[model samples]
Target: MIAIRSSVAQLALLFLAAAGNGALFVIILRLRFVMEQHLKWLEQTYPAGHVSARGEQWYNRPFLVRSLFQFMLFLAAFLSLILLIATAWTHRGEVFGTMPQDPALTYYEEHAARLADGYETLSLETAHPALLKLIDEHFEGETLAILDVGAGTGRDASWFAAHGHRIVAVEPSEAMQTIGKHLHPSPDIEWRLDSLPELADTSASGETFDLIVLSAVWMHVKPDDRQQALETLVSLLKPGGRIYLTLRIGPSEPERGIYRVSEEALNTQLAELSLEAKKLDEQSDLLGRSNIHWVSIGICAATD
Candidate 1:
């Protein structure tokens, strides 16, 4: 089927993109090492009488090759980025620029909310127990209106719906959202098409929630912008509301080791951002690969 082919192609593209980035990164690292070696060689050769007279000169330098290689690396970087972006767009359904904003994210692909049969809540028996504990601590026995941001396929949202809580699931990725509708339907939940950043924007323009769930989403944010995002979330939550999110500590995520900012650090940052972390738990994931843990925070909108 065409759907199968598209899936395969998208996965292939992602693989190629990852390979290209790795290759490019290696090339850049090698070049930097070579440059450092070259500088050392020059310093020793020119100043220490290690080379013949005539200034041991520029004509003997291999700067042209370095320039050519640098140009090639830059070109490859540009092309690889283009390919990665293209592949992401091709595979990810209903994308809107950097963040997806298509209506497919709001409902099931078949356009019906009756297929939700597998939306059951598993106990402390998850591949990741921290998630369940966090959910229980925050949403347990509370009749609060909850918003599950980036609710992939409605697993968590569905669970909340099955319980007594009211939920509005929001997801931006069409593929995931479509699956979610099939998993968590009416008489249980209401799904929406949106992302956290966009939802916060909606909140700023006058939308709100008693509790917001952000699991495994913060790690995607670039290092420079995450703090501002935390502040924005603080602004959106209700007076007594809370945010339950995971913070993966350690060296696994080399790209944006941003969350390496420990829970204590997070607590301090939350304080500055006008949010109070009522309680936080240090727990790991299923794999226990990187020793990751989560910090659950609560907020009220004022400095005083």
Candidate 2:
């Protein structure tokens, strides 16, 4: 009797899960169909000549090719839905409500050695010249207290420390921090494990800095967290302090889970935070990635 009850309960759960998946599948299929029909309508409405030169090519695909594309898209979507449902049911407890794994942390932890070696090989000579120049102009003092947020491998932190500045290198990944400490063993540079939207640990210490550098780090910050992050960083800035941000603009790095960022979007976020933008410079990707570009901005903590 107990065995029969257990089997019945399992069947009920499966049925419930299937029911949920059925609704989702139908919704997804409808959306796909609507999008396809809309695109087809647009093609017919505009015709080839009316379409822009760039868009004309898209509409010029052979009928068979277009049909094949649609079929492939539908098949992909169907398989994705099945996989999502199966995976969720297999790990329901962990997937339904638990926090998602952070890809950046995972990447750093898994590739710590390789990343450290890469950082070691990189020369400060290739550093963004505009950032360096702006730091020099704004920070007139001989020695400044600097905060290197997301200081992976401590490359920039070591550079700042070597230049006679007190450095606080904030890195959240233990593996990355370990490599950084090993590579840049400097008394002037202190390594701390803290992350943003909120630098809770770093903020608890009540320490502020004259200069804060977030190089290749701002892209990791999500859209919703931008304002809070700006506020937190602003609060940690000393009077007349400056911030240097270097953001990568392009598609996300799939492995690292870094998001694409734009200068205009960042400028808007900064304006909302009341931070004064001192400079915004655009540069080609330093690593020779043709699709990627860099935007460096210098901001000041608003003084009221």
Candidate 3:
């Protein structure tokens, strides 16, 4: 809304801003330094400039200009925040149960349901190369049975069958599973009418699996029951087997700027259970605007 620049940076930025006419600016050139110990070389390397920044770098700019602009931007943002707060206070009761439904996920689940309909054409489980590799390499003929925790349409189950593996898929939405089976045709994937937080009570799912997978479904869970949901998912995995999870683990308000999982805290939580974890893979898009952080399979065995 408004600009904030440091005093020294402010003066320089003003000049730059005038030149840019609100179109451009430049900042520091971050250098990544590495030490090659054996060769006894301390090598330093830096990119010439920021991705879009041009002209002199931030640290080299005038003090007052930088400060003024920095202060101005802050003030503008604060004013915007005030407006938002005022609006919220005026409409406090209206925010509850009125938060927008997540249309993106609805779209995703819908697609999954469609895939299930193409049961012969789409196998959700072994369809993804990454997931299938785990099945073939890690649990080959090892008594490992899989449970697709949020198995929307049973594509995963069908894939497991297509690959000669037995499987169970749990989908709470009846319409989705019905469409899924319609696509799959034959009774390949064992479908269950349950959801996360379902108990180990015999009256519940009534059984377990060698591996459990909860992929891209955590964020859809109601906030208060998420932990219980996690516990239930974990319980579904046999003590010596594993659980594969994929969730949004980044900045709390990533839409604003950036964030990542708390490394140490996530580790500590894993240490408390009968499981051990390793990050097996990672993928980034457009310089990590958003990333898919993969936590490798977590294995649990009985505590000695």
Clashes counted in candidate 2 amount to 0
Candidate 1 similarity to native, TM-score: 0.52
Q: Please report, as a residue range, the 10-residue window in candidate 3 with the lowest summed lDDT.
A: 26-35
Write model 3 residue lDDT over 196-220, tens digit each, in one string.
5553431265666777776545555
* Index of the highest-lDDT prediction: 2
Query: What lDDT tens digits, residue by residue, belong to model 2 across residues 1-304?
Result: 2323443455456555555555655665687689678877878897764443333355565454445555655555565557556655644433443545567776776788987776677666576687678777876655898999999999889888998999999998889998888888999999898999899988999999988889888888877788899999998999888888988888988568688787778778888887777555787876678998888788885662
Which regions of candidate 1 are displaced past 4 Å?
A: 1-142, 198-201, 252-261, 288-304
Q: How good is model 3 by TM-score? A: 0.49
Clashing pairs in 2: none
Instruction: List the candidate numbers ranked by TM-score, top first.
Output: 2, 1, 3
Clashing pairs in 1: 96-100, 153-180
Ranking by lDDT: 2, 1, 3
TM-score list, all predictions: 0.52, 0.65, 0.49
lDDT of each: 0.59, 0.77, 0.52
**Top TM-score model:** 2
